[model samples]
Target: MTSIDRKAAADVIDFLHRHFPRGWKDWGRDRSVSCTMARKLLIALGHATRAERGAEPLDPPSSPGSLPRMDDTLLALLLVAERDYGFGQGAHRWIRRMKIRNDPLHRDLAASPDVFAFFMELGAVEDGAWTEPAIPALLRYHAALDPLPDFDAVPGLHAFRTNAINEIPEDVAAEMSDILEEERPSLWQLGMMDLLARRWRYPEGWLAASATGPHLLRIPQDALASWMAVELIRTSRAA
Candidate 1:
């Protein structure tokens, strides 16, 4: 690959690393890393495409309806990565392997170390501020990434922060509420109330408007507390 190609791939990889969770692959069966790898690859692809087209890098694609096209995102990512970044035939094969491993509706199948390295090389080229090649060839080197699955699909967890907010339709949101009520009441309620509060910007009075008889459920309370703790830990680490 040329100097430019390596730089672009490196930039893309760095972006993925920034978004990828720490010890991502080590989490529960290593599914976290796997899931993240796949999803982040999509994001990286979108970024590359936007870069090639001379448009702003798309952090996330926004839509007023359902989720954005993940498959298309992946395809675009691969094509652009290969074309502009010079990822090469070997890298392409590796990506194909990862894609085939992806369960889509079932499990997470994220990027491998080799893939990340390829992107990292491209990123370096994209930046042009650096003049050294950290990795000389893709023929001998490969990256080792882990699995980060869709936690929401996990049996016991229902609460999560997603990119699906801000454009959720009311009807779907209500249905989500009903599903949560049946399976995970407290979480469902928490999610619904949170969404409502955001949308309507209601006052503190809304918090006191619970219709389920003035008492809090233990599981829901714990979930809320856990979420808060996670945020605090993450914030502390960032700081």
Candidate 2:
């Protein structure tokens, strides 16, 4: 059996310690939690790959010519640094998603304004064709952080909203309008508008306003009717 590389393991632990100064408190005591964090970190660092069918035992380094391998015990210790620093699942996911290919270096994965902006643009798309599950997850992650990204600045958001309005039926559009008029718009409302706008194809000015404006309820009834007509014609064509 190949032995674990103690120096490589120590380096990983040291990296975590430097990144997170605090020692793992609540998260360190549980063996299971530590193991989970370690596995995720390994995946992010390209040291491990998740099995599609079921959990597989960590494989030893292929050969001396390949990268050094750490044992499960040392891997678990790496999580102590992660937990001590308050890095959560969200942070782990971010690192995994954004880690660059061809770059073996893995220590620097801090969130930034640019990363947040990219996530906002990702969430702006509502089309089933282009939608991503990660966008919603990232949005939820950012919701807990201060100084949220500006939705208006998200590229292609206007085009996404325009497309949604052009596809939905008139009745559905009316229902959406009613929902908006009756209550304050939340993320759901924003998403609905994005869909309705795909079919409605409202003017660029109006589309932009509706997206960033204070209230969807403030849109004039006549404008809403005009937008609704587009869906009606579309529905009739299919009939």
Candidate 3:
């Protein structure tokens, strides 16, 4: 990946800070306007190539009802990050952390009915899709909502699930393994296993959880490690 020119990026960000001191609200209701503004800024900063700058407008006035294109949305977000938090590795880190935590921007987007609907449609296509790259971020956003959307219906759901499962830190995985191996795993442990099995389509016989009490369940321990390893390997390959 090409490293961003921090100084140059900061200069552009500084310009935006001066113009929009109050954040996104300054841009008004139409996000396309924001995208256009960002595109102009990029061109002025020489950050955008002639080809990019010449690309067709993602939201032409005639298509006012259409959701903003993925490229346009990303450009807008990149500019928004710069406007609110400046530009650098720290800004990038903040964006990634916000995606994971499903806080601030992600939360705000999910809460907006129109924007949420736009994402839902964007996430429905299986191939030749624009939203695949943004699936992980969208999933994280959905996860933060009070009534979580149906993840099974989300486009690229498996990809995000695999990515998330594989990205689990070693220490966390080990702790999970320990908990799953207990004679009577806690309800939380069983619930976690159930979620993994159902969402990732782990073999039913390999690791099954049965509700045996009000808040307790029967969990298999003998094949726990093998089952988890197989599932992880399978998902890693699929992703």
Candidate 4:
């Protein structure tokens, strides 16, 4: 449970998503299925080497594939959260029980395609995998964040005002600066996407947003200058 083998995790997900797109289980009553991908993935995660997955009543393994060695934690979590063939309810209970429910780790893991794929399988595993669906909301909140604009990309304050004087209100620049300084968190705000990925980690309004979305600071379109100013301020403060 210390560290998961990423390659092994991906191998497991690819197998299920391909073959058993409907459901995943170590052992089950569905005799119609003669193959399971358990053994290869388990072995990859440093679990015991077993016979190939077959129509066994208990602990079936998967068809032959080269799986790397890894920790069994993620795989075990999936088993606990799988649909009809496994624990069909919430993963939160298991996640909390296992002490793996930290927001920081979940947010970070969601950025990885493999780990995100694993968690995304949550309620939908037995009914079949997620499609007609984008990444789940929980995972999306944790997905790889958008990259920030380059410092050189946003216009300098002087250059901004000279060409776009009429674009914003007379006093908007000072107002934006006050908002940025007042609203900026003393912690991960400047650090993580201007502060919307908290996922119950922070109180509402702690993160800012506009009509465009939470991803952007709450500046309106008419005030793009304010957005530019916000970025410049963030850069200077960072330096």
Candidate 5:
């Protein structure tokens, strides 16, 4: 391995330390863990040092090699994140319907937004199309984190209103297909809706005023919406 490979390997070791602060053995590494990891890393990168192929321990001097050329950094990052998410259809892989982390991988992608786009595109790699699964909401989230590359070019961005609670939008077979379940930022429980409904003492005689006057209050359906919700008093004024 070259100096670059050594440096990258050292970085991966640092990542392993971060991942296994209590030590790999504590994390339930089998006796054969070293060989398994080293061999897998080599296979994943399509290159290996003689030492990696053998049983000698992996230290700072060894690396899988040429991560950028192989786009193997994703695999490196996934080593940390694979606990929860990843690509491919294997039951072990599920990153597509999940969120990315706020860790090193996230930081790396934040540094190079184009790289982030490329990684996200891999979620739909089987299609072999240039289209990415990214939607306006996800892109906007990236924007807030200072990673959206073509900021001005990505227009028609709607502000995410957390206070505006809504349901999961189960119409998967409709115009809303582009929206992802998690990226539906319009949905969040303020936790006040039900509380206010149950406990807020309405001002004295407000109900009477509401009864006499033409009052209209429109509430959007939220995750808690069974349509069995108790309606609060509605009021209106003549235009």
Candidate 6:
């Protein structure tokens, strides 16, 4: 980490604190929160990029040796931030996706824009080959934030999207695949159902969304599909 990276990281931390939900209050120390911690890593990376360019730093110091180690939480934050900042007018849409927060980690802080953007960029290779599962939508989301590095320049970006997600177009598949991988994994099924409630305009309450209704032995598939539909709408518009 460099001074700029540290500063940017700090800025992101501040951003998370500012944007973290108050009405839906959760967590202990802000630092203990998974999303905030994840954003911190990203802001740190942004600061590093700014420093490498000899630009004035943001705030805190991001020295190279001080770079935070990347983890799945951090990676998920990166993906989110990338989608938010990378897209043009779609920042709010992408940003909203991360509003669900990391309840399992339930530390305190949650992700912000800067952290998510950096992760998206890091997920890709120089040649535009995505190191992760999908590429097209990732690049689109990343490029959406800012065309700075011009992710569009990466070769065969569409190809990467197509191959990764079946018959769907490359970009669409990539975006869907990444979201499914991150947002709706089996490990997070219950959480996903809760997330679906948020997506579907249900009032808050975790069990309210997941529990069975009259004559229902389990949560209805249609209800689940509705949640997925809303998410799809968000991603599609952003992509």
The residue-by-residue lDDT of candidate 2 on 1-239, one tens digit each, is 12235454445544444443442332223244444554444443334455553223335522222222222222233233234333322345334322211111112323233332332343312321213333321221221123433433445544544555465555565665565454443444443445333323222222332333111211111223333444434443355
Clashes of each: 42, 15, 0, 7, 4, 28
Q: Say which prediction, candidate 1 or candidate 6, comes out ahead on TM-score.
A: 6
Worst 10 residues of 1 by lDDT: 213-222
Candidate 1, 1-239: lDDT as tens digits: 11123334345445444433442232112233233333334333333222232233344543222222222222323333332223322334434422212122232223344554443354422222212232111111122232333335543333323223333455645654464555643454466544432331101111223322201111211222333334423432354
Error of 5 at 137 (Å): 23
Q: Please list the residue runs of candidate 3 whose C-alpha ends up more than 4 Å from where it truly belongs after superposition.
A: 1-135, 142-146, 159-169, 175-239
TM-score of each: 0.21, 0.25, 0.25, 0.19, 0.24, 0.23
Per-residue C-alpha lDDT of model 3 across residues 8-121, encoded as one tens digit per residue = 344444545445554334532324434345544443333332242342322211312123323223334333433333321222433332112222223333112222233334
The whole-model C-alpha lDDT of candidate 6 against the native structure comes to 0.33
After the best TM-score superposition of candidate 4, give how far the Cα of residue 218 lies from its true spot, in angstroms: 12
User: lDDT, candidate 5, residue 85?
Assistant: 29
Q: Report the number of the highest-lDDT candidate.
A: 3
Alpha-carbon RMSD, candidate 5: 21.5
Worst window of 10 by summed lDDT in candidate 4? 214-223
**Ten contiguous residues minimizing lDDT sum, candidate 2:** 213-222
Count clashing residue pairs in model 4.
7
Candidate 4 clashing pairs? 36-62, 37-62, 38-62, 39-61, 44-69, 53-61, 209-218
Angstrom error at residue 197, model 2: 16
- For each candidate in the order shown, give its overall lDDT on alpha carbons: 0.32, 0.34, 0.36, 0.32, 0.28, 0.33
Model 6 clashes, total count: 28
After aligning candidate 2 to the native by TM-score, how far in Å is the CA of 118 from where it should be? Answer: 22
**Per-residue lDDT of 33 in model 1:** 24
The alpha-carbon lDDT assigned to residue 3 of candidate 6 equals 18
Q: Which stretches of candidate 4 lie over 4 Å from their true place?
A: 1-127, 142-176, 183-239
* lDDT per residue (tens digit) for residues 37-141 in model 4: 243333433333433543222234343333331212232333323323232222343332112223311222211233344544432222223322222222212
